[model samples]
Target: MQYLVLAVLVGCVALLLAVLALRFGWRLRWLLGWLKGNVLLALLAAAVMLGLAAWDLQNFTEIEPRAATVGTLSFNKVGNQQYEAVLTGPQGNETVRIAGDLWELEVEVLRWHGLPGALGLVDGYRLHRLLGRYLALEQQHDSSANGRELLPNLHSTPPWRDLWAWIDNIEAHRLLEADAFEVRFIPLTDGAQFSLELGPTGLTPVPLNPAATAAMKRFN
Candidate 1:
């Protein structure tokens, strides 16, 4: 929808420019000749802008500064310091058994700067992954520890590529300004439920039930 609005605005601006050039052509004949010669070029430029808008729509999502819930998670204890976590998000419901004292969720973020930022292209994000974590320093480094993945492996198909990766590479080389990878940690408790929120800066986990709140209080 944002892209559609931008395309409409660009078309209106192009039309206005043409109208003004024609209106002033009576006084300056060169302006009229230039407009005639550049008609094809103007059309090409408009087409390019529209193509960019469409590509952006597929690659990014416009996010607001305020926090918004993107997903929910609930856990059921399956073993000592292990749980069967149920997560509901953009990819639908997923269940994974993880072992640890807490769980970590990570997201990939892309922020536009300069003119694109001013033109209402706000921050965009994608669900990266979730992993179980341990509080003990030694357990964290233990290779055999059961710190399982909590999200499925979804691969991009043809025509749907990782544009965010390309943008991040450019930003790393000082060619552009972009933000990526925001992580949040949450304690895992039996029957605890949490809502994952995305804000301007990063991801936050909000307790949605008494079990979750109590767990957060103890964990903190």
Candidate 2:
């Protein structure tokens, strides 16, 4: 809290000083000296900060807590700490999502096409929502409980598989936070260049690009 306050205070002071310098035209000498002396260092510092921020964001994207599921996919420890898929579906809804590595899952292509049945192909996944960026998925290893080793598993299957592929190939904005962020939709890659909010559950899609809504249909 103190650090946040300090940052805010520093920004305000900088702004105030800048305004004063411009208004008075007297701080010109000091400003020039400061710029000449510190400009490169300031830029370097900014670059470092941005780099650290990016690294932190990457870490956040790589890992997520357990007990969380993406859509209907629940992650569980199948065997030997490997991941397993658990499909939970009711009558109308038929869906399959990968477990364990939710945040690691990336969005391939988020088509505005509403899921054909109970499953609607969304622009992003629960994993993408949590991380704030999508793509570069790492397949999870699956091992049988009885000491049998199993091969790696796909992140998602069925209707979501194709969309996941799309997000992988595109770059997009990750919502800062669901409840507080405002999303603008740009459907260049169907969902490649856009920002989206997953809302509270992270499953309830919010602010879907309305322009593409025409392509969307309810499950039939």
Candidate 3:
């Protein structure tokens, strides 16, 4: 929706520029001739802008920033050096096998662009990285290493890099420590933010709110 609005806006601006150029006739003759000679370049530029606008509208989702939840972290110690971290909601039960003793949830900031962003219509964040830490393994490799920062040489996918470039936006990554037998997430505008801690008896949702469940849905 936002992208659709943006495409329309760009088109309108282009139309306005044409009108102005035409209205100024003699005053803008050189500009008009130049435009005619460089028609292909003009069209190419317009096409690129429209394509980006469409892509943005399709990829980006708008949500209530203050109430939005970004991502969740849940894990259970399965063995001496192994743990299972549940991703997203409980229904999926999608788990990742980790050889680490801890986990980190990283978030990337995303904000609206053009007119919508200027008017504050769209602004939020998105999940960039979610990684499990193997503290024991790291200690074995680097004796001086402390788990204050993320493991080095972390690389992102080409599509993700391209999308970031297309949007020309800067992403902020924040690390949150995850505890064993519990799930917690930060309150981000675009991703999942929920807290669920496993107790002695079993697992249960924290805060007991419908939004908690809905947050997982939005985050996914």
Candidate 4:
């Protein structure tokens, strides 16, 4: 991942250098000669970057952040006022899924990737809409616009929403922690079949979006 990110950065710099070289059409020859003076250093940098890129590519292929599949989730009514959800792991998995109660349920993701969606996956915003109930994703950040932090959902910035969005995003991640209603995207095996908290602090669960789960309970 780091190599992927660095390659992207260097690629941009390389592109700019190419543009500038074109702009100095007459000095191109002299610039080429000057570049030769640093050929060894330039070659070393290139080798290092290429090596990093290769390592990053290898890791990307081997690592999967979250196995979105290979697991099943179900919620059931233990009684009239009480609900019980069971999260079980597959043959070779550790993560589990258990929704104690939707009212106190919370789902949060760091919201990386505004990666253009392919396959069945939708872009960040559309995914937000479709899974709104189960997930509560805050708008992404934009540093290039208006010299202020703002919501990534919109193209333009409104100071008020921007400020709220920034503050809320920070608070959301900080306030939620372990023992705050067992978090498992897939199945978690061993230790704490469930996490129980007696205090009010660990009481709330921030489903990535609350709207997506309205139908979850209906499944039972």
Can you write out model 1's per-residue Cα lDDT over 44-70, one digit (the tens) per residue? 988976675456445445566798887
Off by over 4 Å in 2: 1-31, 60-220
lDDT leaderboard ranking: 1, 3, 2, 4
Evaluated at residue 170, the lDDT of candidate 3 is 32
What is the Cα-based TM-score of model 3?
A: 0.41
Candidate with more favorable, higher TM-score: 2 or 3: 3
**RMSD to the native, candidate 4?**
19.5
Candidate that scores best on TM-score: 1
**Which residue pairs show collisions in model 1?**
none
How accurate locally, in lDDT, is each candidate? Answer: 0.70, 0.34, 0.45, 0.32
Query: Considering TM-score, which of the candidate structures 1 and 2 is the better prediction for this target?
Result: 1
Reference-based TM-score of each model: 0.61, 0.21, 0.41, 0.21
Give me the displacement of residue 156 in model 4, in angstroms.
Answer: 32
Question: What overall lDDT, based on C-alpha atoms, would model 1 receive against the true structure?
Answer: 0.70
Q: What's the lDDT for residue 106 in model 4?
A: 32
For each candidate, how many residue pairs have backbone atoms clashing (under 3 Å)?
0, 11, 8, 26
The runs of at least 3 residues in candidate 3 whose Cα sits more than 4 Å from the true structure, single-residue gaps closed, are 1-42, 45-53, 63-65, 70-72, 78-80, 89-95, 113-115, 136-157, 165-220
